[model samples]
Target chain A: MVSILGVGLGVAALLVVQTVMNGFGEEHRLRIRESFGDCVVIAKSPIEGPDVLIARLKADPEVISASAYTEGPALARRGAFSGVAFVRGTDPLATDQPVRQYVVAGSFDGLDDGRVILGIGLARTLRVAVGDKIEVWSPVMAEQAEKGKAPLPASLEVCAIVRTGFTEVDDRAAIIPLRRFRELWSLGERAHGVTLRLKDPANAVATAARLNVGKAGLNFIPWQEIKKNFLEAIRFEKTMLFFLMFIITLVASFSIGSTLFSAVIRRTREVGVLVALGAQRWHLVGLFGVQGLLIGALGTALGFLLTWGILYFREGILDLINSLFGNGDMVANVYQFSKVPLHYDAMDFVVAAAFTLIVTTVAGLVPALWAAGRKPSEAMRDA
Target chain B: MPKVVLQATGLKKSFASPNGPLAVLRAVDLVVHAGESISIRGSSGSGKTTLLQLLGGLETPEGGEVFINQVEQGLVTPRKLLGHGVGFVFQNYQLMPELTALENVVLAAKIIGRSQVEGKARELLQLVGLGDRLRHLPSQLSGGECQRVAIARALINEPAVILADEPTGNLDETTGKEVMKLLLEVVAQRQTALVLVTHSREFAEKASRRLVLAGGVLSSA
Candidate 1:
């Protein structure tokens, strides 16, 4: 029973951690897709005839929508407060504008050449709200000033506020009309890039690769490539955790081996009797092997039941732990999630069960071999 | 004139001791026919048990061969020798403690790949006067009862010869007498050969042929 419980607890711990990690990964992916779309095509210089490129891209079967955009770093000042911000210029009237749904205050439709949308963190930093005026200077204006050609900073009204729930974007992003960006940068009828939303975001990498062919001076990047390091880190952590949790099952297997070894020693005489009664050596080995398999099967079954129970009562269990530790609302405060997330993948269960069963069965083989190695006469005389 | 059921020729066995190799059985020869009972008496440590083990093929003799039912024991597998050729009853009644009396008896049949022997096992238990204790485990049964279960287990496969090594050694006087009587009666009824090894003169005298083993040799008692 103890061995079974040990294996059960180990499996439950591994599965729970894996499921929660998957949930975090999924949530992060969703937020990233919301902010960056499925794929982005970037150019070294402003793209010429962007409308033609957008039309060509939209003609592809995989492309759901494509819109021209311009983005760069800028300095923003509001009264006595000032900060550096990433400025993105987009077509406000585009049907697939991703930031439109994230607008928390005011209206994205009001954005024009003289107005802009501020990310929630930037709005908080600047202490500004709707209808407030903010001064912004492009990097070109800074370069002109360095060359002794003084240029005035553009003054735009804050028409909306957006909170995309992605810390990197929400912290220091500002969106303005595309015409406003081109006018400020002294560019004519050009855009920095075009963002594409595909029919299946999971196919972004393949779509980006296909679209990059024959398109000179434009680099197509998928969301996965954009966040490769973060995703890989999550996967590495999950793998490490799986092996670490398997140690518990390994210890339990050792317990099973120990118990069977003791049984062999205790029943030395009985073993002799069985051998005298015509039992082959392999029969003794099989007896102990079957015992190990039974333990593994029962333990794995109990582990699955434990996993279901833990996931079902996850909220209450978290609440109890938090209350005991005096860390109320830990998930919300640390993870920015209102509740713990769990994602069930069938592969995780299968791998856990297979690993446990194989380890336990192999563990039993040691004692079984020892038992079968004894001579019947030696066993009887010794006992 | 009866058919020869078991034969051992020039049997020899030795053990390695701290001083030197000690010879146990030296040039021992024996033969027994069907429906015959032979008892070999010896002092403690006289290699009586060693001789029985060698004849039953439980121990490999260094310089002799055992034949059961006209087949040399060395030529065939030990499983065949112990399964269909001979049966063993140990001094301590070596029954599996976890198994019931009936299951222990049936286990011998199972070793020979005989599956449909539960009814025969029950009948053997009843013949040994253990019908009421068929469901009792080894730990629950008394010394004599455990010996009876062992005897029943030995006869389950109906081998041609039964090699009993002090089957009543652990029981009291009255229980030992009862167990010996039951063993002899059952072996006689089945017409199976029996090779009995004991230290008791009374039991040895009851066999058809009585012999005494000493100085690693067997002589008429």
Candidate 2:
């Protein structure tokens, strides 16, 4: 029973750590995909006939949707508040835009030639809400004003507020309609690039490579390339944690081995009697091997249950921990997640269970071999 | 012309001691026919148990060979010999402590690849006067009852011979006498050869043949 509990605790600790790591990775990926589409096609200068390029991109089987967009740095000012933001102009009529899902305050449909959408953090900085007006000045307009050819700032009403849960996007992003952006930047019927959503986001890098081949004056950038270091770091950390946590199960297997060794010593006479009664060496080995297997199976089952219970009460447990440690919002402040996330991947459970069972069964075989190797007469005499 | 169920010739075994190699059995020879009972008596540190082990193929003799039911011990695997050819009864009543009396008896049959022997095991237990204690574990049974369970276990597979090594050594005098009577009665009824190793002269006298092992040799008592 002690050995079983040891295996159970080890399995539970490994699964919990692995699932939590998976959850964090999934959460970050979801946020990145929400703020930026799977890939973006950028040109050296403004892309002429962008609608043609968008239509061609949408024709591909892997492409889910494509929207031509214009983006640049701008200064946003409302009343006494002012902050620098990246202004993005997108087709107001496009329904399948990735950022449309993150509209928290108002509807994305409200965006038009005279309206704009503000990121939650940008709105907070400018002290504005839906129906409030803010003046936006492009870098070119600022340069014109410095040359005394002063162009009036474009004043637009805030129609929506989006919180992508990514500080990079949420803190400095403003969206306006494509026509209004063209008028502000004095570009006619041209866009900076086309952002594309794909059916399988995981294939974004490959799709980008295929799209870039023989396409002149355009560079396709996948979302993974945009955040390669961060994603790779998460994956590497998970792998290291898996091996580190596996040590617990390895130690538990040693406990099982020790227990069986003691059992062999204690039952030396019984082993002799069994051998004398016609039991083969393999039979004795199987007896102890089955014992180990039973322990591993029961422990793995208990560990799965423990993982479920922990995931189910994750919020309450986190609250208790925070209450004890006096860092109630540490996850939110450090990881940018409101609560601890948990993602269940079937493969993780299978790997952990198989590894533990193999280790424990091998551990059992060591002592079993010792018992089977004993001479029956010597065994009885020793006992 | 009774069939020879067990035979051993020129069997030799030795153990290593601090002083030198201690010869336990130099040249042990024995033959037992069906339904014949032989008791081997010896002093402490004598080779009585070693001789019994050699005959049963539990110990490999450095010289000579053992034959059980016409099969040579060194030629065939010990598993085949021990499983179907011989049964063992140890001094300590070596019943598995975790198993019930009935399971302990059935385990012998299982070891011989004979399933569906619960009825046979139950009958054997009843014959040994342990019908009411079949569900009891070894720890729960008394010394006499445990020895009875061991006897039933020995008879479960109905082997050619039963090798009993001081089976009643741990029991009281009254219980030992009863266990010996039961063992002898059961062996005779089944026509199974019996090779009993003991230090009791009274028990040795009751056997069809009696021998004493001394100085690594066996002589007629």
Candidate 3:
């Protein structure tokens, strides 16, 4: 039972931890896909003649959607409430669709009518609400605004408040119409970059690398490159976790080995009897191998059950842990998300079960070989 | 009138002693025919059990060979020896502790890849008068009862030669006599050869032929 439990614990940890980590990685990737199309074709400076370039990109079958986009540091003010945020500008239909999907308050309907959408965090920081008009100061267009030389839209109405659920992204962005971005920045019918949504997000790397965006003097930046460090860290931790869990499983296998070893010792006379009764060395080996596999199989099955139990009440479990420890935003900060996700992959179960069975079978083989190697006379005499 | 079913010629076995090699069975020979009962009696350490083990293929002799069912061919492996009509009954009643008495017996047929042996196990158990205790593990059975199970196990394959190694050594005199009577009766009914090793002269006297093992040699008694 101890051996079974040891293996069970290791399997449970392996499944639960791997799944949760996979959940975090998948969730992160999804958010990146949603927020930044599949990839972006970045330009060092605004493309002066982007009409032909944008049309050419849209013609590519792999490009699901494309948008002229711009972003820069901006200051927003409503009465005494003032805050700094990244003012992201996109075509009314281009970024408006995503803003509408995530909008928690108001609507994106009036965004092109000299209106802006603020991320929930940015809205809260500026202490503004839907229908409120806020003054804006742009670092890139600051000289033109002070000299009154450029007819910039000095006040933009807050049409909506969106919460993307990613607090890091939510805390910084204020979405504005791309036409206004061009007017404020003194650019006419051009954009700093274009965001291209691909049919498959993973192909963003290859698409961006091979795309002929240089015709417009535009460079390329794939989303994978944009989020490389963060995703790589997740992958690295997952691999490290797998290694650590494997060590734990190996340790459990040792317990199984010792149990079988002791069983062999205790049943020495019985083994002798078996051999005397016509059992061959291979038969004993097979017998012990099956015994170990049975234990491992049972443990893995029970561990799967345990994982189900854990996942079923995952929210409550996380809540309980947080409440007990009284660590504010503990899970949110560590995982970069407030909630824990349970990823159920049959492949993981298969791999874990196979690894466990092989380890335990090898563990049992040691004692079985020891028994088979013994002469029946010696074993019988010992008893 | 029974033809020879088992034979061992020039069987030599020894152990390494501190002073020198301890020659146990220097030169031992035995022959048992079908339906024949042969008893070999010897002092402790006279190699009587060693000779039985050698004949049973549980141990290989340092020199010489053991042959059974001589009508067939090739050297006998311990594994093939069991299904090739050879059986063993140990004094310690070495039935597998993990198995029930019936499973212990059924194992004999299973080794030879025989199916439908549960009924055979049941029959053997009934023959040994443990039909009601078929599901009882070896630990649950008494010493004599365990010995009876062992005897049933030895008979599962209807072996041509049943080697008995001090089969009654662990039993009381009364139980030993009872077991011996049942054993001889069964062997006679099956027409199988019986090679009984024992310390008791009385038990040896019951066999059709009695031999004394001394100084690693066998002599008619």
Candidate 4:
């Protein structure tokens, strides 16, 4: 029973931790895809006709949607608040669907002349709201005209406030018309890149490989490849947690060995009887080994069931916990989301089960050997 | 010449005790011919049990050689020798409490690579008057019945030699005699060599050859 608990707890912890880790990675990747599309295509030199390339890519069945965008640093000043932000210039009609789907408030429109969209977080910090007038300055535009001069100022109206709920993107970002941004930056109808959405998010890599834009002179980057560091970190953390929790299972198996050893010592005569009846050492080994395996398997199964139960009602449980503790910021702290988002990975469950079985089998070794190594005469003498 | 089934020469054994190295057996020599039932009688401290242990390969002797079926004891690994065919029956009837009498006997046959283990175990159990109690475990059986199961287990592999150490010591006199009778009857059917250790003179007298251990030597009687 104790051995079962040990193995079960180990499997349970490994699965839970791995599932959460995978969920975290998947959630982040999804957000990146939704915000940046499945892949981004950038030109070696500013492509001459990016619209033509977009039309060609859109003709491909693999490509779901494509939109041209430009990005650069800009300073927005309003009263006492002045902060630098990444100003992304995107077409309100072409790029708004995939990128602005996560926008919690305000619509993406009104880009007729000097209108812009500001992230809610950035707007709050700048103490500005929709319809508020703000000054936009770019050093690149200033440098083009004369060196060491203050940036060229462009008076812009805050057309909308978009809340993406991502600190990295929402804290300091704004969107505007790609044409207006091109004119301001003096780029002359050139775009920084085009973001491509795929029919299947999982097929992003294959689709990236199939993207043949030889004449377009563009290089494509899959969203997964772009976030390789983050993905690797998540996988590494999950692996570390798996082994770390497996130690508990190993310790529990030791308890099983101890218990079996004691049982052998107490049942010396019984062992002698088997030996006397022509039972080989292997037979004794197998008998006790099977016992240990059963203990481990049972424990692992129980733990899996318990883990499933916990994961099944995780929302209610968390809510109950919140009711008691008065929710502070666990979701934001742990998952960087407003609530816990979980994904149950079957592969993680298999890994946990396999690891538990191995540990249990290994733990059975000492006891099995002890029982097998005893001489029938010695064992029977105890009778 | 008679076929020799078991032979031991100049056997010696000693164990470390708190006081000193206690000599259990010294220079013990014995032999048993095929199809012969020999009874070895000795007092409790006369190394009767130690000598039996060495003969059964349960303990290594300090000095001596043991041969079963003319195979050099040292040349054969103890485990392999046991698998080949060595049967032991303890006085206390050491049956596995978890296994039924039928399972206990069948397991022995299976380990020794005997085909039709279930059939053989059933036949042996019935011969020992345990046909009705085949499904009973050691815990469920009487002391005498448990001993009978142990006897059935010992014969499961059709071993060449049968060694019993005080086979009837744990039973009442009547039950002890009955067990002895059944043992002799089974051995006679197999025509195997039998070596029994007993304190009862009556039991010893039943054997074709009887040896009494005294003064560190077996004297024929």
Could you list the chain B TM-scores for each candidate?
0.95, 0.95, 0.94, 0.91
Q: In candidate 4, what are the lDDT values of residues B93-113, reduced to their tens digit?
A: 766778899998887777677
Candidate 3, residues A341-372: lDDT per residue as tens digits?
Answer: 65677888898999999999999999999999
The prediction achieving the highest DockQ against the true structure is: 1
Best by TM-score: 1
> What does the lDDT read for residue A168 in candidate 1?
71
Ranking by DockQ: 1, 2, 3, 4
User: Which ten-residue region of model 4 chain B has the weakest summed lDDT?
Assistant: B70-79
Q: Candidate 4 — which residues are off by over 4 angstroms? A: A41-49, A56-62, A109-115, A128-160, A180-188, A199-232, A246-249, A252-267, A292-307, A320-329, A332-339, A342-351, B18-20, B70-86, B181-192
Which has the greatest lDDT? 2
DockQ of each: 0.75, 0.71, 0.51, 0.45
Pick out the ten consecutive residues of candidate 3 chain A with the lowest summed lDDT: A93-102
Poorly placed runs, candidate 2 (over 4 Å): A58-64, A75-84, A97-137, A145-162, A203-215, A335-339, B71-80
- Residues B77-149, model 1: lDDT tens digits: 3335677788888889888888999999999999878999999999999999998999999999999999999
Ranked by lDDT, the better of candidates 1 and 2 is: 2
- Candidates' C-alpha lDDT: 0.87, 0.88, 0.83, 0.78
Better of 1 and 2 by TM-score: 1
lDDT of 4 at A66: 88
- Predicted structure 4, TM vs. truth: 0.84
Model 2 agreement with the true structure over B104-213: per-residue lDDT tens digits: 99988888689999999999999999989889999999999999999999888777889999988999999999999999999999998899999899998889999899
Q: Any runs in candidate 3 off by more than 4 Å, and if so which?
A: A49-52, A74-85, A92-96, A99-136, A140-172, A206-216, A333-338, B16-21, B74-80, B98-100, B118-142
lDDT of 1 by residue, A59-162 (tens): 99999999988888899999899988899988888887778877889999999989989998899889999999999989999989999998999999999998
Q: What are the iRMS values of all candidates?
A: 1.0, 1.2, 1.7, 2.5
